[model samples]
Target: MTAPQTAEQPVYDPSDPSVMANPFPIYAKLREDDPVHWSPSLKSWIITRYTDVRDLLLSDHLSVNRLATFYQSLPPADAVLLKDIVHYLNLWLAFRDPPDHTRVRRILRHAFTASAIEHMRPNITEITDLLLDRLESGGRNEVDLIREFALQLPAFVIMDLLDVPRDMLDDFKEWSDDMAVFIGGARNSGDKYERAERGCRKMSSYFAQLIKERTENPKPGFLMDLISARDEGDKLSEDELIATCILVLFAGHETTTNLIGNATLLLLRHPDQLAKLKSDPALIDSAIEEVLRFDGPTNALVRVAAEDHDLHGRQIREGERVFVMVNSANRDPRIFKDPDRFDITRQQNRHLTFGQGIHLCLGAKLAREEGRIAVERLFARFQNLALDPSEPPEWLDAMVPRGTRHLPVLLNG
Candidate 1:
């Protein structure tokens, strides 16, 4: 990597919330100064270029193992839980690497196959239409897209996939939100902590009941599929079953919701691209890809160096934690043209929103499906949709997640 003549600031903290809000400029400078500048803040080198990021992912030295995360820190179980929570923020696939990753991922393989997604098309469309009905009834009065549509929308689809009762969807949403807080260390010490604890307990109990019921009498949902799936006396243990179910429920709803919200906000911001898409609905597929590229819900992945290794000529001892700024890598000018612009028709976009390598997201197909349908149904319902003139979508500022809390918008009825 060529080191450009960029001045390195004396202090740049990756952990700082303000920096997390927009880390690109700092990333640009870091990539110039060898895309692997060790941050005093994190005490780890940040990899900012696309090639280096991909290279390190495939490198034998960098380990995405749970033990790797707590190499210098927590107890094994606690470390495992922490790493699980870290990936759980993106619903936990982010924690596994190689063998262990390959093992658990198998249980979910058939769950999200292309054919599986096709089987799901009916329910997905139903959910979209149901939401569109509510929006149409909402009348000319401005509606908060996040609250009225995007936020609640994914929860329904996820509930359907999990065969979870509709009444519990609201609770699941709260739990996932609380989990996000815990992951970022942004939770309030009291109410937030209590909420997260309760959420965990409730989720376990809920899935436990479903597991029991599914065992007694199988059904046609994914939960039932898991209950029936057997491989050489290898079935998901009780805890593993609960954990995996929680993982799916939280993942299926939250991240896709954020993706839809992000894409909608981007479209509103870039009227030309929005107009182009509306003029040609066929662009919806690529538009979702562009949205995943322009600003993914996840900004980085926490990786631990598995063994002592050299990164950019600097010795990184085993167990050292490194945060791969995948978000920054996706925007490298070397890989993307005007990388920051919102171009709906952008071809050759291979973004890291779903991540890469062995730990890549399983729900990615489901997410893109949800995104395309939501936007398609949304556009179909609202003809002259524009930003709610008075209030554009304001981003929810948090360290781990990037999305809008409420997207207020107007529609020509």
Candidate 2:
């Protein structure tokens, strides 16, 4: 493949539509030409090698405290506008380091243990069936799968997990999307930040009230567990509790939605692989892993240098942002043979789609099962699941947590 040719920066820009659609070629070029090159466009060092990406993911000096980076660069006006949202996001486990991260993760780990995930399986299957049943009832040969199924399935399931009322799903979804604009690490206009601040206020208030009510009424579910959960003599602070609630609601569905959407699109694009999986249903788990490696949800994991360091023979100053191109690393030639190829049965498919080390995604298990079950039920319900020729899939103009804006597909009744 030809290398990306641009005068502005040799490295590919994440905003480019072509790059967003298919980044492997650019990633391959970067991996070959400048494995640790600094990019003017991204204003950070781009790490493309799989080993470096993996190592940095587990690096102690490189912190995941991105909110600090975000705060340092915040304009006075945007700071005022985004303070509430930023404040809450600062409390997210993803943005924390060391003892703080340990505290929150330990408390919440109870709610996401193996037994918890196992218990959630039947409900997830039931939800998938119910969604497909609804689609069939709609009587449309062509449907926007992202909107009709992929997006809603996770939202519904997460709400159920949180014991949120069914009627509030729409409101929660709106709030969730607004918060994502800020969380996805995508550069947006001032208006977007305003919307996110509003979302932050509304969501925080909503969850705070919910937590308060649960304290008195004592509901049964994940949120209730979090409300009452304790670790030694320490318990979740009110801010931490509210932040955790928002984190679970937002992170829970958003990543899964992208996973389902990206995986379905990849499968539709590669019918042979889809057919292979159909013939051997047991391959669904491995197929999901390949989907993650091929085009996983998150575009990049942002970190900052904790101290002055030399990486790959280049000097990286302390506090400089490093964009770990996960999408690129998954396709690095050194790690996976035929790295660019989409093979479902690829063995030792150790992908960093869910990240690595201390900050591994809390909802990884739930997200994986949701994707597996969603794919199985989706294809099982329709003999012919092909992309809609009437419209092309519109990819979201997002940087992190990449996914399609809309995916229309044709299916048999």
Top-lDDT candidate index: 2
Q: Per-residue alpha-carbon lDDT of model 2 for 74-162, expressed as tens digits?
A: 88998888889888988999889989999888887776788888989999999999989999899789899999899999998988888
Candidate 2: what lDDT?
A: 0.86
Model 1: CA > 4 A from native: 1-7, 10-21, 40-44, 67-93, 184-195
What lDDT would each prediction earn against the true structure? 0.72, 0.86
The residue pairs that clash in candidate 2, if any, are none
Provide the RMSD of all predictions against the true structure, rounded to 1 decimal. Answer: 4.0, 2.9
Candidate 2 deviant stretches above 4 angstroms: 1-9, 188-190
Highest TM-score scorer = 2
How high is each candidate's TM-score? Answer: 0.87, 0.95
